[model samples]
Target: MLILTLVIVQLPQILRQVQEWRYPRCYAAEVEGWAAAYDLDPLLIYSFIHTESSFDPEAESSVGARGLMQMTEETFYWIKSKIAPDEALNFDSLYDPDCSIRFGAYYLKLCLERYGGDIATAAAAYHSGWGTVDALLENGQYTRDGTILAEFPYTQMAHYVQKILERYQCYTELYGS
Candidate 1:
């Protein structure tokens, strides 16, 4: 009777913990379509969104980044013009969940392509900027033989990359396609 009572009391907490460890599919259908369209890993996108804004559609950063992916207006417009020339883009629409995830996936794809498929470097570029990361790599700060360093000189960017990768791995392990 005591064991049953304990199990009943603990079940919800254990389930919540398990769900937390599992991959979060907040915008499931939209994220799925966008991930496929962008050729990005769904888990990576999910982890990125989770880290950037904790899936908050109305999220805004101190630096004026907004929405689920925490994208700045400047970056969003650049990507919008580059990718969707015909699609109308309003600066305020970035706060919308759908737009944010789509834009973020596109930006991630661009980063990956710009960094030659080096996810770590691309992530650094995402957190910092391509120009900064490129300069460092060229000067042998973050990259020596063109491989992205796990132990980067910039502490925040390095930690961000490490955490994202770890969360991505966790998502993949817990719920991979």
Candidate 2:
């Protein structure tokens, strides 16, 4: 049953590709440029977008995050001040894919650096707020390894990390690197 054997071997990869494509990148060029500019992985950005808004550019959280990256207005202003000091910014600008990713990617990069290059920690901070992550580290429940989580204190954040990693793995498997 050579055909059956082939099907069994290929089925998982095909499924993973389909799942990864379930949340396609809406702004590829913006993602590519910002990822490159920030030395971040494109798949990682894609994964965050999928988890944050599922490619919905107009998605807004109850807490007021908006756009493909679900950037908050406060964070948007911070980005404008920190990243592009001279640019005049407004809350509605977060709805723009190009603008949102540019700021979101930079923000993620900052978070990663804050955790000493830990994506999980940075992502945890993103989903659970930086203050919570800081408190977790201060309380000594979570590890600050920077590459892997020694222990994620929050259950919701742990689940968030797992989901993002799964999506990122799927994307990397389907797309090169």
Candidate 3:
């Protein structure tokens, strides 16, 4: 009975540790620094990384998104043009943690700013595209206003946004301020 009681008492801590392992803060310096620079929450960035590649810096998607943040060549080049116009770099740089996190954070900053700080809309735009999300917003079916998304148009994208939101919530509950 005493052993069972002790096990019960330790269960919550054990569960929390397991969850922490699942939602790791892998690139702390890069994540925190770039997040801070972009005026974003580190947990949000961590959630993105968790959902994108499970913190795997070498992860690649079937659609050719590469690295921790899973950026595509098109997005990488666009971001590179915006942030490092003169630097001679290629899409492969997205495989580097520093480059991936920095570029990902900048992209998040742009999405958040475009959506007027609405994380859901920004996440949708991230999974889909800003143009697609903008059309959804303009149709008056997904959003009542142009800012908050009432419903996601695509089911897959809805799930993606939901996963990101869920991870963000978990990350907050586990390691938030």
lDDT of each: 0.82, 0.84, 0.92
**lDDT score of model 3?**
0.92
Instruction: Give per-residue CA lDDT, model 2, range 29-145, as digits (tens).
Output: 999999999999999999999998888888999999998889888888878998888876688888888888888899999888888887777898878778878777776446554
**Each candidate: RMSD:** 2.8, 3.3, 1.2
* Model 1 TM-score, 2 decimals: 0.86
Give me the candidate number with maximum lDDT: 3
| Per-residue lDDT of candidate 1, residues 5-99 (tens digit) | 99999998888678765657799777788899999888888988988888889998899998888898899889889877788777778888889
**Residue 110 shift from truth in candidate 3, angstroms:** 0.4
Off by over 4 Å in 2: 1-20, 144-149
lDDT rank order = 3, 2, 1
TM-score of each: 0.86, 0.84, 0.95
Q: Which pairs of residues collide in model 2?
A: none
Where is model 1 poorest over a 10-residue stretch in terms of lDDT? 142-151
Question: Between 2 and 3, whose lDDT is larger?
Answer: 3
Top-TM-score candidate index = 3
Q: At residue 55, what lDDT does model 3 achieve?
A: 88
Worst 10 residues of 2 by lDDT: 140-149
